[model samples]
Target chain A: MVTIPFIWIMGDLLWNGWDQLSFSFVFSAPQNAGREGGIGPILISTLLIVGVCMGTAVPMGLGTALFLSEYTRHDHVLGRLIRGSLDVLAGVPSIVFGLFGNALFCQILGLGFSILSGGLTLACMVLPILIRTVEESFHAISQEQRLSAAALGLSKTTTIRRILLPAALPGLLVGIILGLGRAVAETAALIFTSGYVARMPESLMDSGRSLAVHIYDLAMNVAGGNPHAYATALVLVGLVFIINVSSSWIASRWTSCNRLSA
Target chain B: MPFSTFFFFTLRVFLVGPLLWAWAWEYPSARAEGERLIITGSSTMAPLVSEIGKRFETLHPKVRVDVQTGGSSRGIADTVNGLADIGMASRALKSQEQHLNGSVIAHDGITIILHTSNPVQELTDDQIRSIYTGSSTNWSHVGGPDSGITVVNKAEGRSTLELFLDYFHLSNRDIHAHVVIGDNEQGIKTVAGNPNAIGYVSIGTAQYDAAHGIGIRLLALQHIPATLETVREGRFPLSRPLTLVTKSPPAGLVKTFIDFAQSPQVHDLILQQYFVPLQG
Candidate 1:
């Protein structure tokens, strides 16, 4: 049963593959019905959203992980509450996060439907996952590393920024990769919150849509389903592949550096 | 017979699988063959199209109709681009959209909905324009409660808002500051929840009571109620035609869909869905 669905999905892609794999369709925007349009700007917008999401998520998620693993080792009430809150926040669906983003960032915060709002919402979704991954990395590091850093008389913050972060870089990169994938693939939350203008995102606050949203919009929103839905899907898959491979390569490099230093 | 059966089985494994795969990937075109009619656009038109699709599919079991909803601009865009066999729009076409044919499937009243507790009864045309355009920012200015008017608006390019702007001549107005929701369902919920909030939504989605909140009150404007009669008679200013646009005038299955959509059964379905039929 599982194999059949996958086979069908692949077959669908293969059947449409040749017509969809054209460079012009990849690069052009839609002019009208029964014609062609490039999705170049949309592709860039998806990348930008993923980039901004990572930019915010990495620091925040890393900070949370550091606080939990190193700073708040002693059992405390506030720490426990914060941990509980993080769990709840992570558990919340992407749609709810989108609603919150719409209200808090887009409306109350007055950042209109822009890349910034979508990225920030996605950051909120990814934070818990990033934090958990980073925390696990930090926990895996021996206590001897922390003691040695203390022996060097480095400040707690400095140790976290330099010693612990570099040590946890491999796992941290994994968290980032996962978050990037989520941000790139996510649609429902983005539809209402991000605003789906096709133009390239000039600033953080400009309204934009990702590849997934673009595909959905084309298939479900537009007539004739845009004929390029498969192409867009292919592009999204390709983009995800690029991000994962690059992140994996960087993680491998970082791991090698850590080994050499050790 | 055994040799032939084995040969056929081999063909199924290779040719059938590859063909099916190719069919799946082929720009949503089913060789432009068979009895598949793909319809997309206008969530407002979705319910109506689905009803027609269900009946149509039953009549011709070999035929399949896929209905998808984006919104009206998308519907028009899809029709112009040949993505949909029919693009259902709640608003009229733009001047640029003259390239396609827009047939009115139904008519809808755009209700000025408020929280049930809101004592404000009516708004003038000028007041409506000012409120939506953000000139009059509070209910106190409009002879309502002392609360600041929370103007919830549909996102830009939404067909409903497009019609409202054109009807009221508020096209150049800056509505970017309003709390912009995407669909009619969300707009109805937002207004129903907040007593100080005012928003416009289709009459179909406005009828249901909000989740654990007060039902919304459809405001009367300038002695013209936002009702079925007022909308059909063209007394209500916010009323607009709902359409299913097609590329180059639909033929075959597309023509059939348009025909069924324009029929009395569809009109009855529209009535049940709380939308006034085009003929009505």
Candidate 2:
């Protein structure tokens, strides 16, 4: 029942964008506000930002999750404080994150309107979910698994490194996938940080517009930009779908490989 | 049990019925005591109309003036459709739109703006054209620092965009824009933020922002300064008249209000909003 509207929207975008989504539309530089030619540069910017966001978020999330689960007691003040802060962070609005990102990364830090600043903002946004997911997965591992690793004369650090990490791989991948989704779909946070420049990112300092921002700019500002906006949305959906499938495949292969080794 | 439930539902409805009725039935035109006037169109003209409407209400005491904003097209449409008593337009009426009468109420001009820190104080018309066309890539080639120039352009359908394109003799499709902004403030902000960026916006707005210490400077247009004095003297080239449109010859309160808006009564108000008066 919930997915009825989702299906309807997807169908509508595909129907609208299908005619415009040709090879030239995807490969050539936009001639005028995505009204002509292609979204080649915009597509590149979108992928560059996703790469940057995932690169920053995943390791930080995994590390924080490990710290919360293994290093501290649940009732410890520091642990409780970390958990409380993560909860609050998750609830913080994306627009507020945009402002904060502008003030800190763009202004104070002097990163300016670049992919680096946008990626950092997205990293902060996805942190809470990452921390909670990885922590839950690590905690769900049996007590006997740890006891056996110890009985086999493995050090606590070694057991956590080899056994715990591989065992929690599936959950970590889930966290990565969710973070990627949020990062790919994000527009507000990137508006202030990355800016709305439809150009290839020459360096980390160069401003670039992501796919989500491109749709927003095309759909809202330009008078006759709906077709291009729909096409970009369709392409964005396809890209996210591909990422989702590939990550799940990688997770499955890991699990299967681990099972064979054991 | 069903009867009790039904009784409770009817009781709840009875309790809320009057509140909903009162909300739906508004006391129309109570303040002005008589006729209602609807003014629609041109977002740029909305503020001025709203200001004049307030003053007109006080003077008439028996007429209600309502101001609405969409765009110039809506203003013309509303006038033609009899949806509004008057339409406000920031651009000149087309030949097809000449079915309606338009009276100039105020004047504003578009001018090039830049970050205050840029070393280049003025740019030649050709230099600006080249910059907009992507022929001039670096700020240093035109006398600023060596950096890639970011062109901030206005979105389509805005009268400002129309005026800019017409004045430059360029098509909107040809100019490569780094950022396409909707409003004047956004253009000013984009220019203020980027030392290498240049954009055009309402000169009055740019002047106001500059007075308030917003790090933006208006450049001279074709060797003539963009100032209130120049615009009033008819020396500025980019000037556009802001008009109040009427489908038919305005009658009653609409006639009275349009006359008042074009008279000396709202001169101070118009100037306060950083627009040139109809006479000036």
**For residues B208-277, could you state the per-residue lDDT of candidate 1 as single tens digits?**
3332244788877678776777777777777778877887877877887788888886676677556787
True contacts recovered per prediction: 0.00, 0.00
Going through the candidates in order, their DockQ values are 0.02, 0.01
Give the candidate number with the greatest TM-score: 2
Decoy 1 TM-score against native: 0.51
lDDT of 2 by residue, A1-262 (tens): 9999999999999899999998888877764445666788778777667666666776688788988888888899999999999999999989888889978997789786677788788888988888898999999999899999989999988987778887787888788788889888998898778765564444555566789987876664442456898998999999989988977776666666676667
- lDDT for every model? 0.71, 0.78
On a 0 to 1 DockQ scale, where is model 1?
A: 0.02
Best by lDDT: 2
Residue B185's lDDT in candidate 1: 61
The residue-by-residue lDDT of candidate 1 on A110-222, one tens digit each, is 77567778878888888988888888899999999889989999998888766777778778878877877888899877865566556434455556667888776555433
Q: What fraction of the genuine interface contacts, i.e. the true contacts, does candidate 2 reproduce?
A: 0.00
True contacts kept of 1: 0.00
Q: What is residue B48's positional error in candidate 1, in angstroms?
A: 18
